[model samples]
Target: MAANRIRVAKDKAELVKSLVASKDTTGPFQTYVEVMVFAAALGVKNKKRVPLGETTKREPSPIPQENFASLGYDLIIKLLGINETKDINILSSREEQDEDKRTQIFEEYANAGLEILQNELRGSVDYSERILLFLSLERDGYPSEKQEFDLRSFL
Candidate 1:
């Protein structure tokens, strides 16, 4: 059975479009799929899952499930769903309803992630640099000085 298309938040559609690299633009990602998946990953990392609000009228066009499946991203998506529910049974269910539920979960995360990206990318002239800094912070956290250990107080 064919899976349903993945939808992005309506309010974030413009942000999504602006993030993609096109002849007229110089965004980091190559395609919308990449942008969406990256945003989803960000959502997962930030533990920010939000239900999708009003969607555009086929604007930006919902991506086909096959696009992700073709690139083996479906597994990553499924793993995220399983992780969220803390139930491996989510992997067993193949019903359309189950698929839709999983899709909803993914979309919600993407929506939240997009909101984060918008806030982080705002006022940045270079998206790549801003994104790299964001990733660095997410990975290593803010730099801080280490306190020296002193045992003389115990004496």
Candidate 2:
């Protein structure tokens, strides 16, 4: 028997386009926009698939990894409303070898990503409308099983 499927928004592109066109450049929304743009730019570096239980070796991204870092930094600036010069100086001065600082930065970015997903649910008429964004990503085979589970739990 076929597994039951959940319904999603009818026009995912249109919804995203409307969101991008909106004037609300609030921290959370801006972060959301940045993430959407970033995700669009991301591409799998390899075409081969591994067996279910095996891990594929990490490959260099199609775009330079530094591009993602720059995008992340831009999101941080928008999300925090920080002055670009001061923030860049502060970020550049950080010890790249410091584990704690690295962890903190990762956490901050994770939080911003989560905020974007959460924001979709908040203003939607129904869960399906917002969840379509995620479903579309999943349909494209973006999320791993664990990530999909976590996202479902969040929903």
Q: How much lDDT does each candidate structure score?
A: 0.83, 0.34
- Candidate 1 lDDT, tens digit per residue, 104-153? 88888888899999999999888878999999998988766686667996
- Runs in model 1 deviating more than 4 A are 1-3, 144-155
lDDT of 2 at 48: 18
lDDT of 2 by residue, 21-48 (tens): 2363213223333444332222111111
* CA lDDT for candidate 2: 0.34
Q: Report the Cα lDDT for candidate 1.
A: 0.83
The list of candidate 2 runs beyond 4 A from truth reads 1-33, 36-65, 69-89, 97-103, 112-116, 119-155
Task: State the displacement of the C-alpha of residue 33, model 1, in Å, after optimal TM-score superposition.
Answer: 1.1
How does residue 119 of candidate 1 score in lDDT? Answer: 98
Q: What is the lDDT of residue 25 in candidate 2?
A: 22
